[model samples]
Target: MRTRDTRSVARAMPWFLLVAVVLFALNLRGPIVAIAPVIGQIRDDLGLSAATAGLLTSLPVLCFALATPLAAALIARAGPERAVLISLAGILVGTLIRAQGGFAVAVIGTLVIGIAITVGNVVVPVVVRRDFPASRVGIVTGVYTATLNVGAMLTSLCTAPLAEWLGWRAAITAWAVLLVAAIIIWGQAAGWRRSVLGERVTAPDSSEAPPAHSASYRSLTAWLLMLAFGGQAFSYYGITTWLPTILHEVQGLDDKSAGASSSVFQVLAVVGALGVPVLANRWRPGSVVGLVGTLWLAMPLGLLLAPELWPLWSVVGGAAQGGGITIVFIIIVRMSTSNDQARGMSAFVQGGGYLLASTGPSIVGAVHEASGGWTAPLIVVTASVLVLLIFGITASARVESRHP
Candidate 1:
């Protein structure tokens, strides 16, 4: 009878874990995204240039790349559970600091927020892998990824209206509410079930371990994939930062309306995130990249050719950006011959990609300022998409794995 009761408890734990993860996901992207819709207001009040305004978005991404080693160390020292609580605390402090509303204060607060998020980014996968069985890992990871998009969508859709109601400073800082909720729930889950959530690490299957002769790092294809991922990251972050501004400037929509429309780009990512894997199961991995890459290209092209069709462009770009990131990781794993190489390639791609991503907003904003029109910025986006296709498509073809 005790054995049966224990088995039932074990069965129930994964759902609890998943729920904790979902709440945690809601905080990660939403806090950063909360800035995008209200960026125009921020620029005006702060007396900031477009490039400086762009830094509001890029600064966090830059931290994601530069502070990763620090994040990994924090995770290692604190453990994923404690590290998560620490991350939430940091985000709360940062949000409050950001609310004080000065240029230096904003930058410092954003930097702190970014560093905290990097900790969560590195540790959450460890939490999922440790808590769930192999069969359940994929599903948990998928939910984590999808929920990220949901968080971004909610913030993009709501932040402008929230700003109108409460003013931008209070509005951006309002996201701290999510951090507090995540802390309470995750704190309880970890405190009560520490043993289950921090179960002994599963021993790796020998076949999945890296061989002594790992060579993926030396591959030119690996370098190309890294650059391709850079392009994808560049395109996604650039557009995400500026799309609402562009709409307001070009089509004369109010901030609230422009932000609401931009939400279409973010929300549609749910479809693309889940759809890419399913499509990959039916088509060649490279073929999937090609199709999605074309969709990415169409976004900027559509915007440039017919700004009247901005809605269509947003939808296409939304799904494409989501799938674009997914497929690059898929190809990274596919191109690897062993777990070690795959891990190395992933770190390499992500580290380089984010460094490039950190420049996207500033570069695009500067171009827009220079040209005094959306045409230059759209062309810049179009060129980045072409980079993804050229290198991403080439690297995607090198997939040796039977499944994506």
Candidate 2:
């Protein structure tokens, strides 16, 4: 609440931002990850086809992609603070709508919720960069990544038990409460914003110093980074949506165990998401990122070929993949020369990434329907990773955009 800078709050900004990152991270995966574990049950209850079920589950992600550009426009106009608050509010409302239940309503609700997440996803990095010094960015990003995995882990694990006890709607609605909690904490910390990070807002030498950028998308480096980020996103959202169902249907695991396995994958992913960055940050980001793509290609194959062992392999694989994702964010930070560039880069990667990612689950489902088993879907996953690897190899370089 205090605007004045203090030695204590300055030191505490790292911790406070860490907590805020965790809160924001927690909000992200809960809505979408919660859907996968229960998809089978919902299909049976609602009598959905594989395609319909996939769309039902993937609707939120689709909206996530659709919403990013809009969030960017708003952030460009209104500032990140107002955009995030509005997003959090939308998440709460959407979760409540999903709680009311029935196939159409639930899908619509989740789509809205996903749109809300896009806003959070876009803004949090801006907040981090604005609030933290360069030396600490990796640590904060790693912690934030870990907290997001924690949320994803909880979302995967909690869905069934809560559903069993209170029904599916209640399970779905539970995450909304966490968003409400975040609003309160964020309010307390809003005053800390100015002290946290500096923005390079230069005055024009004349009335107009050629608008910041005529087009934000002109830079090849920016496109490469977005593609790299999208590669990671595509793999992550693909797995989160289909992993539980894959385990249950293909590996002969039960519903409960399948869900637990999915949760385990996410929990282990926390290590990857947090841990990889610690190591990767030391190297040339481009070299490190290519390795990330390689890991993506290898791990999912293991999951498909050896389903029984994936619970263990997933720990290794998920962490590697998760770390790759954290690296993607790190690249976004390192590649940009200025705050405006960083903000623009964030918008580009997230907007394109979510759009690319939104198709993963649905495409996986559609593939499964065509191939008659998980084999085809696994191949598709493998291919997606290869694409990611290619993108990361290009993006990992120390590159910055000349334009916005």
Candidate 1, residues 267-385: lDDT per residue as tens digits? 87777777886776667867888888999998989988887788999998888988887777656545555434544555557667788888888799899999999999999999999
RMSD (CA, Å), each prediction: 3.9, 4.1
Q: How many steric overlaps are in each model, in order?
A: 0, 5
Tens digits of lDDT, candidate 2, 242-271: 888888887888877876766666777777
- What are the runs in model 1 whose C-alpha is more than 4 Å off? 37-54, 76-79, 125-139, 160-169, 188-194, 197-222, 244-260, 281-284, 329-346, 368-376, 397-404
TM agreement with the true structure for every prediction: 0.81, 0.85
* lDDT to native, each model: 0.78, 0.73
Enumerate residue pairs that collide in model 1: none
Q: Give candidate 1's TM-score.
A: 0.81
Query: Given candidate 2, what's the lDDT at residue 190?
Result: 65
